[model samples]
Target: MPLMNWDSSLDVGVDKMNDEHQQILSLMNHIYDAREAGRSGPDVIALVDRLGQVTIDHFRDEEAYMEQIGYAGIASHKLIHKDLLDKFTGYASDIKGSGGQVPEKFLTFLKLWLTAHIRGIDMKYSPKADLLKAG
Candidate 1:
């Protein structure tokens, strides 16, 4: 089974962002697959690192989109992004130092955070906020 699943509730009413979210979900699964396949510790760590980088890039893109659309909640949203990144980095660091399978708590964190962030937070900037919603 995949480590992450993207559902309709996570749709933020923007094509680009939704695509990025799907990509992130795929990367999460790749990390799980690597570990399950008994890939080297470094290999798994690298996947984790790649996930982090991809998430950072996605957040930057999302923020830029919000700015282009004049999202009123950009400042607070950016702060939330920062907090999420900090927590993600902490989990990545822990996983790297431990040198084993991804922790269950980490997986839980990813699932919960992505679900809520997209469905709850991201959706706030959707609809009237996102010009592409009408598309």
Candidate 2:
């Protein structure tokens, strides 16, 4: 089974951000599947590293979009992103140090954080934009 399934609830109402979230979800599943298949350490490590990069890119884009849309929480959102990235960096570093074998706890953290951040945190932005519409 996938580590995390994307539901409509995770939709942040921005197409680009939604797509990026999907990509992140997919990568999370890939890691889960790799573990199930008993994939090698180096391979899993590579995937983890790629996921990290993609996350960084996505966060940058998301933050920029938040700014452009005048999301009220942009400042706090940026801080949250930084804090999450720091946490993720620590987890990724641990996995790499252990030769790429991702632990169950990290996967658990991944699920919890992504779901909460997207639904609880990210869900805040879209409605604001909708409220501020020109039309």
Candidate 3:
């Protein structure tokens, strides 16, 4: 089974953002696959690092989109992003410091955060911004 699976319900009504989210989900699964396939520790760590970086890039893109659409909740949304980034930074540090084994809590947190943020927080912006919802 994949570490994480993207559901259509997680779509935030924005094509670009949804694509980014899918990429994030793919990267998450890549980490799991790497470990499952007995890839080297460094390889798994690299995947984790890439996932973190891609997440940061996605947040930047999402924030920019929010700005373009004049999203009223941008400030709060940015805070949420920052909080997640801070937590990711800490998790990355711990993973690397401990030789690349991802803690269970880290996976749990990522799963919960992505699901909640995409469905709850991300959903709020589109309707408020009057953007056309994508299928």
lDDT of 1 by residue, 41-76 (tens): 777888889999999999999999999989899999
Model 3, global lDDT = 0.84
lDDT (tens digit, per residue) of candidate 2 on 66-99: 8887778899999998998999999899998988
Model 2, C-alpha of 114: deviation from truth (Å): 1.1
RMSD (CA, Å), candidate 2 to true, equals 3.1
Task: Summarize candidate 3's per-residue lDDT along 1-135 as a digit string, tens digits.
Answer: 897788877877788998999999898778767667656467778888999999999999999998998888999999999999999999888888877887778877888888988988898876533454443
Pairs clashing within candidate 3:
none
Off by over 4 Å in 3: 36-40, 127-135
How displaced is residue 113 in candidate 2, in Å? 1.2
Local error of candidate 1 at residue 28 (angstroms): 1.2
Q: Report backbone clashes per prediction.
A: 0, 0, 0
When sorted by TM-score, best at the front, the candidate numbers are 2, 3, 1
- Return the candidate ranking by lDDT, descending: 2, 1, 3
